[model samples]
Target: MYASYKNLKIEVKFQGQHVAKSPYILKGPVYHENCDCPLEDSAAWLREMNCPETITQIQRDLAHFPTVDPEKIAAEIPKRFGQRQSLCHYTLKDNKVYIKTHGEHVGFRIFMDAILLSLTRKVKMPDVEFFVNLGDWPLEKKKSSSHIHPIFSWCGSTDSKDIVMPTYDLTDSVLETMGRVSLDMMSVQANTGPPWESKNSTAVWRGRDSRKERLELVKLSRKHPELIDAAFTNFFFFKHDESLYGPLVKHISFFDFFKHKYQINVDGTVAAYRLPYLLVGDSVVLKQDSIYYEHFYNELQPWKHYIPVKSNLSDLLEKLQWAKDHDEEAKKIAKTGQEFARNNLMGDDIFCYYFKLFQEYASLQVSEPQIREGMKRVEPQTEDDLFPCTCHRKKVTRADLLTHVRTKDEL
Candidate 1:
């Protein structure tokens, strides 16, 4: 017999407490807003503006072009264009750590892993410490403030004094990585036993304290249309599941909730189930089959079925060839991804991104000796200096530092 939406279930447990229960129903017709369409259009425009032949001809004619003062050109560009001010701020002493993760659903794990790798491989700031959300950390382990820092839950307020800089939101990469990781972790639990049993799986709402906060989210959604889609999908899925239990009593870590709510079987098999339809459109339809069956399946073979079947290797090869034919466009896309990674994930970016706010905490003026010592301790390289601001005992503007170096050279 074909499985019905009634067959799907999820259980919610927050801080060892069960608050509510609901059914998991796969609603028809999921829709995704075409966010990339505009980006694609923009790329096409750039291609038209700077065709390869045009670029080549321009390069050849460069010798005959009139020279202009770069400084004059720089001065001409407005610091703030129209009403859009720079969202980012830079200062000499601000010490902020911005975190980003990758992937749509399952990409958060990849992002975290990447961040961890960056932390270990990249340079470490002397006075600055690293942190991930408390809810994201392993539940079995206790957090040590002395060793590493921790961010409070999204719903909780943190002391501005304790934090040198404001936390930038998680990147799409991080969210996607988390989604994949959650699926993988849940899949393992489902195969192993009773706790991991599919019958017991559930989703719950735990973040906000009252309807007012929830309403505020709705208000915010108006200004940021992306939130309308993303947040609505999340809540709708939580509400639709019947076998699923709780919008748990309080907020809980995904790890702990998974561990306590389900049991692992002795044979290494996990119980699997689908979540409810959260979004109102057809996009969810495309994801429906695998979202439940394939995502939770333990065996690799069943999972393969969830993946769309390719008619033949040759057909796939043809698509790859077509991509290669548009090498310049492909290169641009690759460069964009690399730049995204560098701007959002690199160390210096993280620092400068937060430093603007962090500088406000300083009461005493920072001196050159202190800056030199801090620089010596961190020894930041180009890769490590991805952030906008540099960390010294005192913050120094990048422009000022460059001018000083140039002055020394002239001497």
Candidate 2:
């Protein structure tokens, strides 16, 4: 049984509390709203959209882009990544740090690690004293779950008690993260030349229909073809359900992100996970004001790093027109955004933010356990007990990331 195994386990611990260790199941990214396909079927469908080859020379030489097995790697992802959770306001009255999540939901590993990495900084901090699962799940959503909201700053979203910690991809959170840019691959595709040298003048966006805003964007793109170049990214999901999407559902290469002068960044289920990469690129980021946030959103300024659009995207065309007329300013904003991302959003920077955020949050909790009235503890199950699906990425906090120890240790 052990003959074929490579990396055996991934246990994540933070301040003496079991954040999550792996051998856990993941549900994969196959949500068709009205269809229930087999695990292989869903994984096969998702594989079409995957980046099979690594962009960097090192990753290519080492053959490190796609994992040997998605499900196996997914098994080690912590429980905080993908599933839904009870969102909350994080009032001073609440006494426990409750993480009610699904291991299979998407991006669980990165989500968990961000929180776990932070607590490792100091030992005096308090850990999760009690696991609260009220008779009913009450923390599923928040009335004010904006990007990096003031209340419960360490949590991922007010909608989910996920690790809203510092990630290069806070909006960079969700992705086919298995073989994408991690902290280990240092040669990020930053916009080296000026934006004036870019080929495409119009704004572009190529992602899936994770949120209603993306659909609206596709519609806007259709109406204003000259200014927008947006498209849906699902091949199989839209083949069955094309009612909400436009005619185009194309596959975008990683290099394609730098092809244009302007890049449109929109929120998916929450914040757009790919925003940081876009900001780091040569193109100006045309962002939408969303309730969903990330760890560094508070630090980013509008017009300085990116052009802010209405949450409704009502002013996208106007913003584009302004950028086109004011080419110098657009280029400057893009350059500034890239600089900010390079200096502030690096892997080490992200880890430091997580540590500081964790320390600050831990300082606030100072009382006996006040378990919620209805909450009950739920144990986690791995892929063996429940069929697993999905991925893993490199941790940014580590210094010697390129040397793969190749043991059943952390990935």
Give the per-residue lDDT digits (tens) of candidate 1, residues 1-411. 111122334556677765575334434221111111111232343343332222221222122223322222222212322122111111122221233221223232333333333332222222222222322211112233322212211111111101212122232222233343343322322332232223222222223212233333334334444212112223333354312322334334433333222111110011111211111100111111121121112222211212121322122223333433554443343233323333333333333322221122222223211222112122222311111222222357788588656656766
The lDDT of each candidate is: 0.25, 0.51
lDDT of 2: 0.51
Minimal lDDT window, size 10, model 1: 277-286
Per-residue alpha-carbon lDDT of model 2 for 203-259, expressed as tens digits?
A: 889988776777788889889898898888763434554665656565866557677
In model 2, the Cα lDDT at residue 291 comes to 67
TM-score attained by model 1: 0.19
